[model samples]
Every structure is written in C-alpha cells, then in structure tokens.
Target: MDERLETLAQRTGQWLRTHGWRLATAESCTGGWIAETVTAIAGSSDWFDCGWVTYSNAAKARQLDVPATLIDAQGAVSEAVVAAMVRGALARSDAQVALAVSGIAGPTGGSPGKPVGTVCFAWGGPGAAVRTQTCRFAGDREQVRRQSVIHALEGLLQADTTAKSVP
Candidate 1:
C-alpha cells in the first residue's frame, strides 16, 4: 500500500471512531481498493461496516440499488450514479456514513468526452447532504485507482468535518 494512502485511511478510521460512526463503501473503478485500504488499519472493523464492489453496471444496480435507467442515461461513471450508490450503501448497511466511487481508469476505456482517469466520487450520510465530484486524474490505470482511493478517503474525512460544523 502507498504510504500516503495508508495515512489517509488511518486518519479516516480515527475520525470515524472518534465520532462513533461506521462507514460503508460502494466501488466501481477503484474496485474495492478504498475498502481494502480502510480495512488494513487495525480495529477498522469498529468503524467500517461493509463494502460493495459494484464493478459492473448490473452489480451496481442490483447490489447498491443504483437505477439501471440512471446508469444508462448518465453513464456509470457519472456523479449521479455515484451519489445513488452512496445513498444505497447507507440504506442497505448499518452505517452512519458512506462513500461511492466510479471511474474510467484504464488505458483503453477512454473516450473523447469521458476519457480515462475520469473518476466521480460521492460522500453522504443520514443527516448530511450528499456531496459529489468529478475529477480528472493524470496517470495510468494503477495510479488512477490509487489516486481515487486516496481521494475517497480524504472526502470521507472532509465530509465528517463538514457534518461536525453543521450546528
């Protein structure tokens, strides 16, 4: 594991534990990398709830309840799909927080509009409004996935901070 990624995961686990919150993940391009990184931390089971590797559109729709029509209309890598994924993950799991990721991380999946390294992320919870983003990372497949994992972890931490300040 990359040292930076490991550090982010550790920070995320610490934050969730401090807030007595559990986290769930819904992954697409990053596969289960985000889940794997967080679970690598000791005692992560206290803060991590579950992870769904929805690599295929069918899996996203079936496991996370991401609407197939939404995926077909907006594409699987869109922010809308990731937002739905996070919502579905939280709905399906006993988690207080959740993050979702979808991307075109590849040397071959690039198109003119949605080129490779295009990743979308979402972070949400029961009371917090769902936040979504689309990022264009510059790297090969492995690097893009690595960046996505790191970004997802960071987003979780940021969302926690935002939720804390909402009062």
Candidate 2:
C-alpha cells in the first residue's frame, strides 16, 4: 500500500475517465491487488468495471476464455497466456481497456528459465495494439507481489500513453 502506488492508480483513473474508457483486469500472482488498488479510489466504479482472479489454469480457461491448449503450450506465466488473459478480460466485461498479469511470485516455483519473481504483463483495448512486458524482480513473496501490483498500474498508464501518442 504505497502512497505513490495509490497516486499512480489515481493518475490511471484520471486518464481512463478522460478517455471515457472502462477497465478490467485478469490477475494471477498478485491475486486481486490491482483491482483492490483501483477500487480503493473513490468513484472508480465509473472506470473500473471488474477484475478476475484467475490464479489457476482452469479458471483462466473457464472464466476468461483463455484456451487450455495455449496454457499447456506456453505455460500460464508466459506472454501468450497474459495476452490471452487480456483478451478474455476485455471480452468478459464492458470495459474498453484490459490488463492481465501472471507471475511466479514466491520463495519457491523457481525454474532456471522462469524463476520466482518473474512477472508477465499485457495490456490491450478496443482497436489498440496490445503491449506485453516481462520483468524479473528481486524480493520475497510479499515484496514481489507488491512490485507486481505497482507494475500493473504503471502498465496501464504506459499503455494509454503509448496509444495516445500513436496518432
């Protein structure tokens, strides 16, 4: 619960409202922290439509329409999965903008290729090009999750900035 994070979320809300767009999130490792941050802002209901905590592959498939085959092929934390998650979030809600996050934020779950603190993010919107990013954070479980939430909010801001600058 960093105040700067709250400020970032507020800034994201301002931009979303200015653009007259709503947002939805499909979260995994950070649980619903991204959703919790946005909803903490007063009047966020105007811009934040909903959030799905698709922690399991089954839930991702069932709730967000993320294909099981994709997860099996790319793994849940991969960019492809996050991309599909963003699509699913956009499709499931009335939100015009969507963000998705999946990560291995743990003291465990570390592979040589995809270690703990490896978080993947994707952001997309109607007629807007999707953006994806991968980051390796250094921290414990709580710290990694906190960083993931911050990064997700930052992604929303960054995505909007990139989209607006395109034309």
- Candidate 2 weakest ten by summed lDDT: 158-167
Please, what are the lDDT tens digits per residue for candidate 1 over residues 1-167?
A: 77998899899989998899999999999989999999999999999999999999999999999899999999999988999998899999999999999999999888999999999988887676788888999989999999899888888776434221211
Stretches > 4 Å off in candidate 1: 159-167
Per-model TM-score on C-alpha atoms = 0.93, 0.93
lDDT of 1 at 121: 87
**Per-model root-mean-square deviation over C-alphas:** 3.3, 3.1
Alpha-carbon lDDT of model 2: 0.89
Residue lDDT tens for model 2, 1-167: 57987898899899999999999999999999999999999999999999999999999999999899999998999888898899889888999999999999989998999999999988887787678888899989999999999888888776434322111
